[model samples]
Target: MNEQAAEIRKARFGALPERVAFEDMVEEKAVLSANHARDAYDPDGLAVRFSCLAADLGL
Candidate 1:
């Protein structure tokens, strides 16, 4: 990320978790299929990664 984006992120997230860093990088891959059905994304399989930020952030 660039300096400006880093500043914005720091302001929004306070301090990022150890999993994130100013220079850290991650590789991402996604499968693209029928365009129309993509909008109806499902996440049942990824439930373990779900976070209720509303409660965590006291929002």
Candidate 2:
């Protein structure tokens, strides 16, 4: 590529981001107890939702 094109590209998109450490990159969260009373705790809920979505989208 020409120097003018390279300069224009650099001007449009600045410097690339710095590399992040693996530990810093990942988000760590404590696992909640399965016995918690929440609607999402239902095992078949995901499957039922997915099926409904697929039907609606005609997938």
Candidate 3:
């Protein structure tokens, strides 16, 4: 019975996985985008420019 069980186990899972301690597994790292700049300036300038453009177009 033991020999039959061993053969069945071997057939089910071809080989045992390489043992890896949990601590040895790769860990996630915090990532942040460095190239992007925050738009901290007020939208007044954009509003003024867009209003002028719209007026010129009679929109």
Candidate order by lDDT, highest to lowest? 2, 3, 1
Off by over 4 Å in 2: 34-59
Error of 2 at 11 (Å): 0.6
Q: TM-score for each prediction?
A: 0.24, 0.46, 0.32
Taking all chains together, the TM-score of candidate 2 against the true structure is: 0.46
Candidate with best TM-score: 2
> For candidate 2, lDDT tens digit of each residue in 20-53?
8999988989997685565455757766656676
Model with the higher lDDT, candidate 1 or 2: 2
Candidate 3 backbone collisions, by pair: none
lDDT tens digits, residue span 6-50, model 3: 999999988978999988998988886564435555576667556
Residue 49 displacement (Å), model 2: 23
Tally clashing residue pairs in candidate 1: 0
Deviation in Å, model 3, residue 46 alpha carbon: 8.3
Deviation in Å, model 3, residue 54 alpha carbon: 24
Query: What ranking of all candidate models by TM-score puts the best one first?
Result: 2, 3, 1
